[model samples]
Target: MPRPRFWGEALRDDESGSAALEFIVGGVVLLVPIVYLIVTLGMIQSHALGVEAASRHVARAVSSAEGAEDADARAAAVLDSIVREYDLDADTLDVDVSCVGDSTACPAAGETLRVTVAASVPLPLVPPVLGLQDATRIGVESSSVQKVSRYWRDG
Candidate 1:
């Protein structure tokens, strides 16, 4: 008995589709992680930039000789400006500003002025893929030393 011609043709054709199938599977496997990494880094960069701006504003305000208490209002104004500049909702963000100045002021010269901002945002296809059902919450903190001008105090 001899094998049928149809059977031999069918086996040869089966091997033809195998390469196409492998390429599709490999593409899907490689694409997923690359996409995830790009998204994660982008999110982190945005948060960091916002924080850097906030910290600079707070530091400039606190460095003035008026007093640390006066800096509080200035800090709030700076934070509001950041929210507007970044197009982020005010309600979604929390800002905390701490200043250190003269003895009567914050009692620590050259000390840190810290600004912290936190926000919660939805991460599309990220949390779910990681088996998480909730949105991601990101927090950023930036600190700078107060720079008091001697000329201002002397005048």
Candidate 2:
């Protein structure tokens, strides 16, 4: 007959499966934060890329347009398309258009058209309560400068 073990004897017995249990528990504790970090980084990087693309395309469209009205239309179109494609929040998006010349008018002939795009990306799992999401948001910005063609005209 097998001998019945006392509580002390049971405690002294070789621990089976303890390593697996510890590994599972430890892995879960470490893995959750690691995964969250990766997801948050991905979101920030996507927003950065989106802002960059928006600036570049907007500058290009403005510089290439034939007139001020055309330039406005082109910039708006490009910004809208990039915002949609990158899943960026238009409400938080800010765009600045300027000219690197003595004249304040943008996209002038022989001038540099500068387009700056900025946006905020909310962190993953951030709660909207108490404006925590807004407080925890990461800001991303990008600027692009394109030279306007010397032949550029306002028709």
Q: List the residue pairs that clash in candidate 1.
A: none
- TM-score to native of every candidate shown: 0.60, 0.88
lDDT of each: 0.62, 0.91
lDDT of 1 by residue, 60-111 (tens): 7756635545566777788888877865556766666554543444414555
Instruction: Judge candidate 2 at residue 7 and give its lDDT.
Output: 92
Compared with the true structure, model 1 gives a TM-score of: 0.60
The TM-score that candidate 2 achieves is 0.88
Q: What C-alpha lDDT, on a 0 to 100 scale, does residue 70 get in candidate 2? A: 85
User: In model 2, how large is the Cα lDDT of residue 22?
Assistant: 97
For every model shown, the clashing-pair count is 0, 0
Candidate 2: tens digits of C-alpha lDDT, residues 1-155: 99998999988896886999999999999999999999999999999999999999999998888888888899889988998999999999999988877786666798988889999999989778998989999999999999997778866
Q: Considering every candidate listed, which one attains the maximal lDDT? A: 2
